[model samples]
Target: MPTGPTIIGFDADDTLWHNEPFFRMTQERFAELLRDHADPDHLMERLLEAERRNLGHYGFGIKGFVLTMIETAIEVTDGRVPASTISHLLNEGREMLRHPVDLLPGAEDTVRQLSQTHVLIMITKGDLLDQERKLAESGLGDLFDGVEIVSDKKAATYTRAFADHGDGAQAGLMVGNSMKSDVIPAIEAGAWGVFCPSEQEWALERADPPVAAPRYHEIASLHELPDLVKTL
Candidate 1:
């Protein structure tokens, strides 16, 4: 464990549990709901645009996504969208909120094992209430030394989090699916950044890997994390 991190941070959503796929499913339903108004590909583009525009206003989470869907629906249909369609979208959002948390393969075991030697923290960005619910449902809440639910992930954010919770950013490592929100910024903040790519990543979270960084690492699954901690 020589030169190992003093703290390890994990991202929620698609990192530890199934998330993007629910959004994907809901979006597919949305496209079907408005199929008469626009083609599926074009509708997806409009929805993506709406999400980009609305991120600052609504932030990230199911709530923001659902709102963006409604906004996109209105824009694409020129405000002629039926009230019933809107109602159906609302129900879809509610269903997503109520969806059971499904932990990713090896997620629970990874966290449980790492929590033994390192000060483990869950640093994620999303709706506060919804995130809290997922963590509670995840049954791994007690394993974490800390949990940070922030509006966004940035270099300053990781610096503050690791400083407050452990030795500092220099002794921290963040593992997650997003190169943008999880890996790049954490490395920029002076912590090790481990990228564990997810199956259903959102486009906004995609970014080029920090291939030349000394502290950057990539693993195909959470199953590889413990050995990573040992080596680092």
Candidate 2:
């Protein structure tokens, strides 16, 4: 009956299109705006701390990042950070929101080809509206059988997603750049996990991969995905 993955999960953001570069650009601006209060290195550290601490409250995406930047600015400056710096940070976030979605090479083709044989589910975590906007703009939105913009990627999340959308986790596969969020959780949920490393991923997303897992796999990029899926 089932040969390989009947349900394929694709991670958005860095996997489908460009994402980290915008965040990096905004971080640069954030550091420049706060240069007077803290050096770039120290300010970035504080920003990261704020992001890590605020994830539970803010969840994820541009809006939360802006809030973290503003919070970090006030903290690093001892509440002396100027309103103009805060305003600049806000504008930078808006720019990130407005940035065009640039799909990774062959990302569309891979999704399209796979959709011919497998049910494709987009499982990504971020601000709901922002994720929707990016997907709508990327033109790959119509290709996915279903879309899931969850708050976080966990084993339970993948288990439910695969169960609802396909035969079950055993017949599903998750492909993404994050070892922590995409690969690890999918494998834990009993689906295949395909690691597609991007040019740059967030430090928080890094994890020692599940190399010993019989279902775990690593690919150079999303372009390699369709062929690999054929073998799975």
Candidate 3:
């Protein structure tokens, strides 16, 4: 095994930039729009259920999320949700898509510094166009050696990504906020997994940390990443 990772993969969403908070804000708006039909807590539960069910069909991203919200609205209101409410949900998604890419403190600097030594790749799963747009707007696009906007972050996906980057699993490292999507999968694939917790987390992405995993590491923020990678 390599002394340290030869190729480091970063999860684009919450790991590097602001993401879930926007979704949360949108969800709040959605709840307000449907307040008369259902209690906020109940509506949120239904919306989450709709999102979970639609994941297989639409995958993850703003578009699927918006559709799920619409579905939830229709269901919660018994198909009586007004067209105006549906339009509001659609507009919320549009606003989210147009939201600026706000890089977490030190995210850009860390990537830039690491790119000078090791191969840096972005391993994010979401709507292709939206992810691509964020990447382009982030202005750190040139620093990444490769980009993988996958449908899911499974072990097989990480293995393939590592291989495609000219490295085996043991020579790769994955850094992200979600233990479920970013850390556990990479660790299962024989790569080192670094958990960098984000301020906001989606319920679906939450998972217990793999504390027993020898290759698993956790950092408070992206700023701590460079030092951790150096020790690896």
Quantify all predictions' global Cα lDDT against the true fold: 0.95, 0.91, 0.94
Native-referenced Cα lDDT, model 2: 0.91
Q: Using Cα atoms with residue i matched to residue i, what is each candidate's TM-score against the true structure? A: 0.98, 0.98, 0.98
Task: Check candidate 2 and list the clashing pairs.
Answer: none
Candidate 1 lDDT tens digits, 1-232: 4477999999999999999999999999999999999999999999999899999999999999999999999999999999999999999999999999999999999998888888999999999999999999999999999999999999999999999999999999999999999999999999999999999889898899999999999999999999988898
Model 3 score (lDDT): 0.94
Candidate 1 has a TM-score of: 0.98
> Model 1: residues >4 Å from true position, as ranges?
none
Model 3 clash number:
0
Q: Report the error of model 2 at residue 59, Å.
A: 0.5
